[model samples]
Target: MEEHNIFSLIADNLSQFYEYTGFANATFGHILMILIGLAFVYLAIKKEWEPMLLVPIGFGIIIGNIPLFPGLSVGVYEEGSVLNILYQGVQQGYYPPLIFLGIGAMTDFSALISNPKLMLIGAAAQFGIFGAYGIALALGFTPAEAGAIGIIGGADGPTAIFLSSRLAPDLVGAIAVSAYSYMALVPVIQPPIMRLLTTKKERLIKMKSPRAVSKKEKIMFPIIGFLLTAFIVPSGLPLLGMLFFGNLLKESGVTRRLAETARGPLIDTVTILIGLTVGCSTQADKFLQWTSIKIFILGFLSFVIATAAGVLFVKFFNLFLKKGNKINPLIGNAGVSAVPDSARISNNIGLEYDKTNYLLMHAMGPNVAGVIGSAVAAGILLGFLS
Candidate 1:
């Protein structure tokens, strides 16, 4: 009888312990989310696409979906948790501006300054944001939610997160994930659009090389850029201000250490925090829904529209220019702010047709401008919605 009681007590304790374990709380949704998180890590490692952003985010997803039994303060949503504190940066929308500062410090605007016309291509790419906005409204999303969703078209993850956190906090995770995923998939999405929109000759055409931009011009551009953009859209000050300030640090031929810190450790730290918290926000219950699916579809459409618009706009813009002065439509897809990746894609495709026609420098012009334009568009949305 005593042995039997001891065995019974052991079984009871084992069952009680299992109840407190993730195994007991795990659901299909949790398992599905964990698989999705694993997929993210797999893509990051094998594909080498945006690994810096994806790795932390993927791990965070797993952590967030660990199926806690509740009443524990360790979960992201639990009050007074460490993750809750880290998440406050994302929720409050401060992470994005800091990311922008790093972007500015690291970015070399010489490409854009050398060819001002490419800025128009970047501006044209923003058509997708409005295009998605209309579609989201028609699909019955609220104005604010639609606005947050529309920013995904910019292919700028930080901007997407910033606008969504402020305008539609509930959709921040979906919007951010959509934005970053599209950004990562730029190479896959943009090349087909480029080929469809341009002829082989168009892809082969290489225009005059960009002239050297003076250091003085480089220094002045950020200052003037900030003043003009901020004056026009003060709502963008948080992002735009930091962007120009960081650029000034780089351009001023001074504050090298400050610029290094902003671009290096500071940005790295912020990226990890923002990526992890953003991923955590997508807890299985909150993320796996019809709404997120709709957002994903809308985000895809927006990115396609943006990519197509950039390429088509370049083709159209070429009409007024003389034959030699015509811009290569292949670089048009770079106007969606995927940065060096989009620019590199233009170069890769351009090389396939003509090994001599290097489009990297030229594509960088619109690519960098897209960064500025996306931020401006976000501010416009903020001004209207928030």
Candidate 2:
């Protein structure tokens, strides 16, 4: 009888192990999230959508979703876990400044310097940030959270992450993912808005060549730009400071080694950490909430509004300009702050309308300006809301 009881106890212990393990404990929502993660991987590998970012992010999602016992305390959010340690860079907003450094190194400001007036187009597009802020507030988010969500419209991922980390750390996962996702979709999203807002004549219109910028202007731009922006919005100095410093390194002509390192290895490392931590932050329990859906909706609306605002602002500007000086409205779509992607879209759309109308160089002015504009907007919101 004792022998029989021992055997029964062993069977009961085995059954408890089977019942308590991840295979049995994981909910349907977890499965759904895992499948969504796999879909991201497919998009990254097969569709080539932001492959550098999405590949690591998708893989991280898969790693993050692997259900583990709470006692193990090894999940992304669990204290003392490796992922949680790595995620501190994101949470503390260190990754964004570094990413900005890389961006500044890669950026060429000659186009923007040659045509400073185009900076207005980038400024006009920022209304989308305020527009989305109001919308998010109406949807019942607090002012701080709303401010974070609103920045997704800026289509600037690092800025989104930076602002959201400060203003709404809880929503950072959804905000970051939404911002990057829309940035990757710039070609699809901006083209339709670009087409609908402007006519063929507007798209075909080409502006005069920008005045040649001097080496002095190139070198002075970073120093002057830094002082102006930093003094105006001290909160933005963390991002803007690093950005201009990196630009100075690139333009200084003597810092080629540092510039190359920032643009290449440093950026690549930050990107991988940003992607993985962002993905891991989206563990199903946190990301499956209604707020995540709301954030995604607000993000999409913000992007569309920013794009339209840019195109229409160009049309508005054309009303004042003589025909010879009028800017191409298509290039205004570059004001959504998706960097070269939006500018490239503007260029491609321009080519389709007028084969000879090369808008790339002109469009780059607003494209880089949008970067500055978005950072400023984030600082404004961070000041007011946070």
Candidate 3:
């Protein structure tokens, strides 16, 4: 009787240890995931690859890979766990919308409105999105998965997240990381392609000064544009509405305090949350797949194709216009959704050609339009997949 009692006690303790540690059952794949998460952190801190996002994502990846890491027993939340709470917001699709609001507050639409024709450059750049989607489909991804992957070409983080949430939630973290990573690397990615596509004469081509914009036009622009966009692509309302609303606040004289807050404190706070939440989604199990590698490769290719497409389209547009009205092909590269960074690069390259040339304002036309184009592309993907 005594021996039997001791044996039963040992068995109970062994079972409890296995339940608590999870190492009693962890596999090789699980260990590989932890290493990948650490690699992301190393790259973020050491290589500085979008450190804002990579740091948090790396931490999240680590936390997520721990076996039985408290409430992850069945591969999901069971309440009272840190990941459970964070995971809820992502699953509910909350972060992307809030992030959109912050993005709107940060954007300046003056350039886009002053030069509506540049909107076409933004539209032309989206060829990469469709082109990538076709390639992804060819690679054997389902339509929904390919759509999520293709938005990487847009180079817009929030739009990618929004599309991924609806189309391919499983690939969201990888897609978002890839999108932002390429956007940050725009300077490196774009110039080589631009140089290859345009000759010195094209690069040196002088562009006319953009027409002056009026305050009244600025105030009315967001409203009219929002209405047009909402009517035409209701699916884009979440992104476009927030963006235009932010712009309205900036342009409206009465909303100085609100605009200041949106551009400053509000965006800062949300960026922290957005960064951390995005990072947390990079758990090894989800991130280290063969598909994840393919997504990154596809995203990089999409960006290259988009850049090439934009430059070629602008050159094509130049053929139809009078000489003085011709646009600098460098500005065409800004049509991809890298925002101010790509636009700044365009301005820099223009200065390289002619010290007096200022392509910043001109480049912004396509830069802002790229935002709308990305949202539209995302909407199209959602339409097809959802």
Candidate 4:
């Protein structure tokens, strides 16, 4: 009886050990995703590519992929899990509006107001969204999925997340990651396209300074922009509304405290939560599909197309302009919704040809316009697809 009891105890201990070992149930997919997560962390730290977002997202990816025993209620997807609670901000599309509020607070509309015609460049770049939409449709995605995927071309992560959550929840993780990753790579990806399309002369072409924008015009912009955009694309109200509100707070000249909070702490906190939740959403089993791969490919192509469209639009504009008044096509690349990074890239590349030509302020005109254009494009897609 003693020997039998010893054997029973040994067997029970082994069984418990086996039960606790995550490696026992871990699949190849989990390992692959974990490695990919580590790669994101490496890029964040070593390359310093959007570190604030990439680091949290990378770590969250690792957290999401850790194998858990069956029926555990603590996983990100588990109904009652803490991660699941955090993830609700993503699933219900809460984070994007808050993020837009922050963006609006921080953004300066002076550049855009100074050169209102450059707004056309931003609108023209949105061609990428429709282009990707058609491609996704050809590739067999549903209208809703295609619409969500198309937003990736806008190079706007928050907008992508918001659209995906509304139209294709299954793809939120993939779309969000693709949009952000591409946005971060704008400095690398956009220059080649900008260079490829423009001649040396076009890049060197210098424009006159933008006209001064009156303070009254500045104050009226948010109100009018919001009203016009909201009435045209009511579906975008959540994002546009918050964006205008935040801008109003900043430009109103009386809400400095609110603007400061929105642009600083509020945005930072929301960015962290958004990044982590989005990363955690990419669980191995869910994310390791052909659809996610397709989304990435389509997203890359969309960005390229958008950049090209902006450049071509500028080149076309030059056909009728006097030499002295000709706009630098290089600034056109900033039409992609990557914001200051795209504008900065345009400035850097322009300097390679002519250091005297300052394109930053000019680029910013289309850069900020791209933000509005992308939001409007998203609203249009949501209207048609949803």
Candidate 5:
């Protein structure tokens, strides 16, 4: 009888231990999310698609999906967990402005400054955000959630995150992932649209070289840009302020050290933390919903709309410009603010059509403008909705 009781106690303990194991707690959603994470890793390593962003985010997805026994403090969402603490950077919108500072430090506004008309292309691309806003509303999301989702169309991840965090904190994970995913896929997505939107002659067209911008212009742009933009939509100051500040640090020449730190170590550290935490926030229960699917679809639609709007708008704008000054429609795709990626696509596709037509510098004008335009749009949305 004593031996049997001891055996029964041991069996009970073993059963309880098994209950705490991942296999016991795991669900179909967890497995699905893990597979998606692995796919992201594979794409990063094998395809070299946005490796910096995808690798950290992919690994984070795996970490987040690992089934946990209830009450464990190891998960990202569990209060007092290390991951939870680290996640505050994303949750509270601290990482985006820091990243913007890095971008400003790294960027050269000379392209945009040399040709101010390109700024209009950037502004036109924002049609995607508002277009998506209407669609999201039709789909039944609240004004705030729709506003957050719409920012994904800008193809600027940090802006998407910043806007979503303010407007719809609950949907931040889906919106952030959607924004970054599309940004990373710019090479794949923009080319076909660029080809479809314009004729062969339009793709081959090349404009005159940009005028050289002086040191005074470079140094003054950030200050003037900040005042002009921030004064218009002061709510965007968090992102726009950091962006312009970083630019000033770089262009000021006196602050090379500060610019280097902001563009290099500081940005790298913040990127890893932001990417990982954002990935972790997409726990199966939270991310695998029908709403997430809807967000992804809307995100794709928004990106497509933004790209088309830019290209089509250029075609319309060309009617007003004289020959030799008419912009290459290929560069219009750069208006979505994927930075050098979208600009590079513009250059590469133009190269495919005509080797002599180099559009990189021209494309950079609208590419960088897209960044500013997106931030401004986010501020406007936040002001009205939040």
Candidate 6:
């Protein structure tokens, strides 16, 4: 009886150990991932790198690391699990599209419509996306994975999310965080590249005052932009469609209530969910890889390339334009889609050169264009990969 009892006890202990350790043994890789996730949270809160995004991401990383938590186990796609639920929305490309509705409602396209030429600058800046894709491919990523990583150069969070979700869902978390992180750091990341690429004289080059756009033109803008974008890049429909639709609501004048809902309640709720889910996906095992480091490095390089491209494009355009019609090269940095923040930074820098030089309106032209360019690049990648 005593011998039989000892065998039963040993069997029970072995079962418990196996259950706790998961399929593979608990290893250093797991520990490293948890630390990296914590580091992301610290950066989000302490350094204030898009706190709205980083905080949730940080928390999610912690939660995701609680080993053997049944429904929260890593890579398990079973229903009722935390990751499974979030992964569903990410894999299906649902969250980003919804988020775009809010972004569209909030975007103001008046500046871009007034100066259609600036649209070319926005298009020029997307060279970074392709540039990064080529580099990532060389670094050994499959074409689909490289495409997802390259979209980070667009500096457009939702577009990055959308493309990653579709082409490389496994990398959605890292790519999204890197895209938003660099975007929030635009005030820091873009200025050095801008200054290096432009002479102080060029930064002070005052641009022509923009002509006032009519309400009718504003209303027609979204419609025309959407049609052109959709016709050109059907893969971009998910992003461009939501963006233009939001713009339509803002410009239409008839959908004031709808616009308010999109801008306010809709954006707030989606941001919370999106941020949390994004954070949750950054578990230790997945995030602590050598590839994550490469993604971060590539993302920063892409931003630098995009900034340089925008500045060079402006200089090239100046060579052809009449002297008085030239744009301040400083505004070219705003071609990154960091929203009004990038535009505002350009205006502030221009003010330092010439106090009366208000580059905000001019900067906005390229800023909005960057949004479209990123989506178009995403579309092209999806075309090739999807």
What local distance difference test score does each model get? 0.92, 0.90, 0.81, 0.91, 0.94, 0.83
Candidate 2: tens digits of C-alpha lDDT, residues 1-386: 99999999999999988876779768777787788779888988998888887887887787778777675668889988999999988899999999999999999999999989899999999888889999999999999999999999888999999999999999988899889888878888889989999888788897899999998999999999999998999889888998999999999999999999999999999999999999888888888999999999999999989999999999999999997999999988888788888999999999998889999999999999999999989888888887
Q: How do these models rank on TM-score, best leading?
A: 5, 1, 4, 2, 6, 3
Error of 3 at 202 (Å): 0.9
| lDDT for predicted candidate 6 compared with the true structure | 0.83
Query: What's the distance in Å from true for residue 343, model 5?
Result: 0.5
The list of candidate 3 runs beyond 4 A from truth reads 1-49, 66-80
Query: Which pairs of residues have clashing backbones in candidate 4?
Result: none
Q: What's the true lDDT of residue 146 in model 3?
A: 93
Per-residue CA lDDT of model 5 for 217-292, tens digit only, reads 9999999999999999999999999999999999999999999999999999999999999889999999999999
lDDT string for model 4 (350-380, tens) is: 8999989889999999999999999999898
Better of 1 and 2 by lDDT: 1
Candidate 1 per-residue lDDT, tens place, 1-386, comes to 99999999999999999999999999999999889888889999999889998888888889999998888788877888999889988889989999999999999999899989999999999888989999999999999999999999999999999999999998998898888888889889888888988998888898899999999999999999999999999998998999999999999988999999999999999999999998888899999999999999999989999999999999999999898799999999988898889999999999999989999999999999999999999999999999
TM-score of 3: 0.88
| Local distance difference test, candidate 5 | 0.94
* Candidate 2 local Cα displacement, residue 232, angstroms: 0.6
Query: Per-residue lDDT tens digits of candidate 6, residues 1-386?
Result: 99999999999999877876645445576566567568878887888777776677666666556555444345434576666777676667888888888888998888888889999889889988889999999999999999999989888887888899989988998898788778878889888888888898898898878889999999998899899999999988988899899989999999999999998999887777777677667666677788989999999989988888888999999999998888888888777787877888888888887889899999999999998888888888999898
Which should have the higher TM-score, number 2 or number 6?
2
Q: Tell me the alpha-carbon RMSD of every candidate.
A: 1.4, 1.8, 3.2, 1.5, 1.2, 3.4
Better of 1 and 3 by lDDT: 1
After TM-score superposition, the amount by which residue 366's alpha carbon in candidate 5 deviates from its true location, in angstroms, is 0.4
Better of 3 and 4 by TM-score: 4
Higher-scoring candidate on TM-score, 5 or 6: 5
> Which 10-residue window in model 3 sums to the lowest lDDT?
69-78
Error of 2 at 274 (Å): 0.6
Better candidate by lDDT, 3 or 5: 5
Lowest-lDDT window of 10 residues in candidate 5?
49-58
State TM-scores per candidate.
0.97, 0.96, 0.88, 0.96, 0.97, 0.89
